[model samples]
Structure formats: C-alpha cells, structure tokens
Target chain A: MRTLFAAISGGLFGTGLMLSGMTDTRKVQGWLDVFGNWDPTLAFVMGGAILPMAVAWALTRDRSPLLGGSFPAAPDPRLGHNLVVGSVLFGMGWGLVGLCPGPAMASLSYGGPSVWIFTLAMLGGMLLAPGVRTRLDVMASAA
Target chain B: MPMDWIYGLAGGLLIGLAAAVFLLANGRIMGASGIIGGLVDGTGRSNAAERLAFLGGLVGVPMVIALLMGFVPDGAVTANPLLLGAAGLLVGVGTRLANGCTSGHGVCGISRLSLRGIVATCFYIAAGGLTVVLFRHVLGVI
Candidate 1:
C-alpha cells in the first residue's frame, strides 16, 4: 500500500538525517572549516551516499518514474552567466551558514524546537527562488 | 557513539532508499535541484508536485519521527539566524544559476555521467573549497 510505503519511507529518511549529524549546524560549520581543524566526517557520509545513489540512477534512468509516470528527461539548457553567478553565491552561503537544503532538511530530525527557525528560512528561501531567478535572468539578459 | 552521527546515517539511508524506489517506480532520478528547477521553468508540473512531496518528506517526516520516538533536538536550536537566512537566499540564487544543486548535479547528474553535470560539480566543489578557504583563511571567520 502507498500508505505503508510512505510511513516506512518517512521513518528511514528521518533516521538518516539524525545519524548524519546534519541536524547540528556546529558540526556542519566545523566541516566547512576546511583549513581549520577540518572535520572529515562529511566526506565519509557523502561517500556512503554515492553507492546506493549510483545504483538507483543506473537502474532508473531509462524508465518512466513510478510516481510521475514516465516524465521526459530534458536536455541541459547549459552554459550561461547564471551558472557562474549562482554557484558562487551558493558557495558563499554554504561557507557562512553551515547548512544548505539537504542538510537543513535532515536537521529537522533532531527535533529541538528551534529547528523550526531553520525550516522557516529554508521554506522562505524556496518560495523566493522564482523571483530571484527571474531577476538574475533579467540581469543576464540585459548584460 | 554520537547521537547526531547515528541519526544522520539513518537519514541518508532513508533518502537513498526513497531515491531508489522513486527510481524504480517513477523511473525518475531524485535530484531535488533538477526537480525544483523544472518547476521554475514550467516544463514539469508533475515533476514539481513530486518534488514538493519529496521536500515535504525531507523536512516534515523527520520531525514527526522524532516526536514519535521521544527524542527531540534541543531548543529548536539554530545558528545565527541572519546567517542562515542569507545562506538560504544565496543557495536559492545559486541553485537557480547552476541549474541544479548538490542533489541534482552531485547525485543524479554524476550518476548519469553527464559532462555538464561534471562541469557543474567541479565548479561547485571548487567554489566550495575556495569559499571555505576565503572564509577561514583569507577572511578569518574561523
């Protein structure tokens, strides 16, 4: 049943967040401190993640998505100023905040009440995404 | 054993499994960046809904699990709020510009071995490395 799958999936996902230390911004900040004491845990975690991910991608790329049902994979729109600008900003933000979308989503599993603050910021960020994209694109177009 | 480490592993397993299943059933790569990007371009509403659901699961289900398990993170604790806000905004902008994020380029794109994804990933890694160096070494935030 979809209900059973959903419940089970939710549990596993939450558990992963908690185990990965993503819930702790301190750990994240420490990891990002590349030249300063450089916690290497994130490396192992990202490494652990690659295996299953690779399996899934290889198996799934040619078929239709079960939930989305055969949605077409589009060609890359590639190569423009947006790429350069966006990546730079993303890196800057990650360097400063110690959390990005993936880790931020995972941190919610830690369950302290303040996690909500991070969540709100994340949602707010996501919502503002379109507008920001448009502005950047417009800037690119004019430039 | 640190509590957070254990929890993070569990979380990664969950995402991996879900990603696997989504791949099997939907035949879609679970690249949050790409899915989210498509929503912006209006090329994939269906992709958009699934992405929303996936994101919702990423954020909500974790807390729900913690609630049921009776082990909540302390204090709803967070870092510098302004820093997080700025970070999130910048990430949004960056993801838009890159045409994907770690999930898209790092996970899905890498899996496919796409040249573009490789280039994007390289850029992301380089930028992240430089940013870390800049913040800690050049700027001395650390």
Candidate 2:
C-alpha cells in the first residue's frame, strides 16, 4: 500500500513537472536569467504548487497522517555554513545547466547525450557525499 | 510570448497534489534529491522498496506520458558534455550537502513555514540569478 501510493505520487509529480514547462531547461534558465528575457511561468508554477500543499500542511496538523509513519519534524532552523555554501553551489550548477535532479531524471528517456552525462556525473557526485561530509566533520573537530 | 499560465497552474496543482499524497499517505516529504540520494548513500535502506517504487514511477510515468502525449521538454540543453557533467556534479553534491532541493525545501518546507526552507530557497535562487548574470550577461559563455 505504501509503495503503491508512493508510485502514484511520483507519477503525478513527474507529470506536473512536464506539464508546467519545468522539464524544459530553457524555460528554467529563462526564469533565472533575470536581466534577460525573464519568463514568469515558474512563478505561476510555484504559486499553484503552494496552494494545495499549504492546505495539506494545515489539515494534517494535530492528527496522524493516513500512512502510519510519524510526521517528519520541522527541519532545523539553523543558518549554518553548510546550508549556505551548499545552496550556493547547487544554484550555480542549476544556473549553468538549468537541469535539477527532478527534471533531469524525468527527461532522461529523451535527454540524449547531455542529460545522460549530467545524470552520471550527478550520481558520481552523490557517491562522493560521504567523503565530503567526513572531511567537513574533521574540519569542524579541528577548529 | 504568452506565459502559459494555465498549464503552469495545472501542473503546479498536480505537483502539490502529489506532494500532499506522499505526505498524507506515506508521511514523507517528496524530495527527489533526498529520495534518490538516500538510496545511493544507504540512509534509506529501511525504505528501499518504497524509494525504488517512487523512482520507478517518477522515471517510468514520464516516459509513458512522452510517448502517449508526444510531450517533450521545450528547452535547449547544453551541448558540451564536460560542462553538463560539471553542472550535474555540483547539483548532486550540493543538494545532498544541503539536505534538500526545490521540491523538498521550495514546496514542502515553505508550505510548513520552515525558516531554513525559506532561507535556503532565497540563497539558491539568488545564487542562481547571479550566476546567470555572470555567465549569460557578462561572460556570454552559456
């Protein structure tokens, strides 16, 4: 039951991404290209997304969600160095290629060479995450 | 160009619905990077079946939709393989390091009114905007 719901949710999310023009790297890039011909499509997408999600958050409060697992606690609010630096790095990459993981993975079937290369490298990077975290931990300890 | 507001809204709604379902039914955040990242880094072993199912649907449904509806992404992608690879590396590493991405932080986090989500979103969007200015406007390399 959990897996079925997960698959359904994933499918809907992918469909939404494709429908919202998010799958197009050009559209995403245009949104980021503020000085250039900025397209406001993404704004609509964001607004549309927030509506129902906001409702869900409100309704789910004070009750156990339908699935059995406990609701995830609110994320830590600390404005730490890792969060800042990591986000900037993510943004730079997003700006450069205009392909985040969601769209990149969704469009993989037809993304050809470029998408394939990006996906492979992205996986390689994920694989290296432990090492990076270990190094960060070491630095913190030394400091 | 007319901003396809209708499509955007419809798509966005569907996305929200999906997130809501994942939250309501599974009690999990629908973060793509986190979902996939956890699988790779071994933090998600307990939920491997669920994660795999979600990914299977994520990748599979899009392919089916593309075939049935003839929908293809309208954006042009980078032609240079090296640049594409580098960008991919950054996104993968950064999302994992930060522990969220557009869907997780931008959608779920913000809806819950989490400060970290809002701040992270602001930082990344600003950084992305600045990068475009540098690369597209100043350098003209992209």
Candidate 3:
C-alpha cells in the first residue's frame, strides 16, 4: 500500500513537471534569467503548487497520516550555514543547466545521454556530500 | 497570459497534489533529492523498495505518456559535457547538504512556512539568477 501510494505520487509529480514545462531546460533557465528573457511561467507554477501544499500542511496539523507512520515533524526554524551555502550551490547548478533533481529524473527518458551524464555526476556528488558535510561540521566545531 | 502559464499552473497544482498525497498516505515529505539521495548514501536502505518504486513511477510514467502521446516532452538540456557534469555535481552536493531542493524546500517547506525552507529558497533563487548573469551575460559560457 505504501509503495503503491508512492508510485502514484511520483507519477503525478513527474506528469506535473512535464506539463508545467519544467522538464525543459530552456524554460527553467528562462525563468531564472531575470535580466534576459525572463519567463514568469515558473512563478505561476510555484504559486499554484504552494496553494495546495499549504492546505495539505494545515490538514496534517490535526491528524496523522492514514498510513501507520507519522507525518514529518516540523522543520527547525533556525538558519544554518549549511542551508545557505548548499542552496547557493544548488542554485548555480539550476541556473547553469535548468534541472533540479525532480526534473532531472523526469527528463531521463527523453533527455538522452546528456541527462545520463548529468545524473551520474549528480550521484557522484551526492556520494561525496556526506564526507564534506562531516568535515565542515568538524571545522565549525573546532573553530 | 501565454498558454504556457496555464500549463505551468496546472502542472504545479498536480505537483502539489502529488506531494499532498505522499504526505497524507505515506507520512513522508515528497523530496526527490532526499528520497533518491537516501538510497545513494545508504541512509535509506530500510525503505529502498519504496524509494525505488517512487522513482520508477516518476521516470516511468512520463516515458509511457510520451510514447502514447507521440510527442516528446520538452527536455532540452545543455550538450556541454563539462558544464552538465559540473552542474550535476553542484546540485547533488548542494541539495544533500541543504537537505532539500525545489520540491522539498520551494514547494513543501515554503507551503508550511518553514523558515529554513523559505530562506533556502530565497538564497538559491538569488544565487541562480546571479549565476545566470555571470554565465550568460558576463562570461557567455552557457
């Protein structure tokens, strides 16, 4: 049941990405290109997505998931160096290639070899992040 | 308003609905990076099947749709191997480090008014725009 729901969710998410033109790298870059030919389509997409999710969050406040596990706990409000630095790096990648993780995966079928190369490199980076994070934490503590 | 805006909004709604379903049914945040990243890093070994199932659906559904529709989904990415690889690496490390990406932070976190999410989103978007200025306008590399 959990797996089924997951697949369904994933499918919907992917379909959404394709429909919203997010799977297109140029569109993504257009959106980020504020100075160039700025495309506001992504803004609509973001706003549209937020409305439903905000309602979902509200609904979760008073009840548990229909499934056995608990809903995700509230995120910490504190700002951290990891959050800021990591996001900047992620943004640079997004601006460069116009693909985030979700779109990257969604585009794999039609994205051809370029997508594969990017995905593999991304996986390699993911594998390396933990060690880097640990080192950063150590350095911060020592400082 | 261009038709693309409508498509984008409709698609965004569906994406949100997907996240809602995942949260309500599975009790997990629908974070693409965290889900796949967990598997990559071995932190999600306990629920690897679920993660794979989610990913399979994410990749499979779109492929199947494109096949049936007889139209390719718009997936134009940079052909530059060096740029693609570097971008991929940065996205991978950055998302893992931040513990979220567009879906996780931009959608889910922001919806819930998560401070970390909002802040991260702001930083990333700002950084992305700046990077674009540098790469596209200043350097002419991308």
Enumerate residue pairs that collide in model 2.
none
| Local accuracy of candidate 3 as per-residue lDDT tens digits, A1-143 | 99999999999999999999898888889989989999999998999899999999999987999878788988998888788888999999888988899999997888778888889989998999998889878877888
Cα lDDT of model 2 by residue, A27-138, tens digit: 8889999999998888888889888999998878887779797888867878776677778888889999898888888888766668888888888888887788678768
What C-alpha lDDT does candidate 2 achieve relative to the native structure?
0.86
Q: Provide DockQ values for all models, in the order shown.
A: 0.42, 0.75, 0.82
Candidate 1: what's its TM-score on chain B? 0.71
RMSD of 3: 1.3
- Report, for every candidate in turn, its global Cα lDDT versus the true structure: 0.61, 0.86, 0.91
For residues B1-142, write the lDDT of model 3, one tens digit per residue: 4799999999999999999999989989999999999999999999998899899999999999878887654436778999999999999999999999999999999999999999999999999999998999999988
Q: Please list the residue runs of candidate 1 whose C-alpha ends up more than 4 Å from where it truly belongs after superposition.
A: A1-11, A66-68, A71-77, A109-115, A138-143, B1-14, B33-49, B68-78, B136-142
DockQ for candidate 2, C-alpha atoms = 0.75
Docking class of 1: acceptable
Comparing only chain B with the true structure, the TM-scores of all models are 0.71, 0.94, 0.95
Q: Which CAPRI level is candidate 2?
A: medium
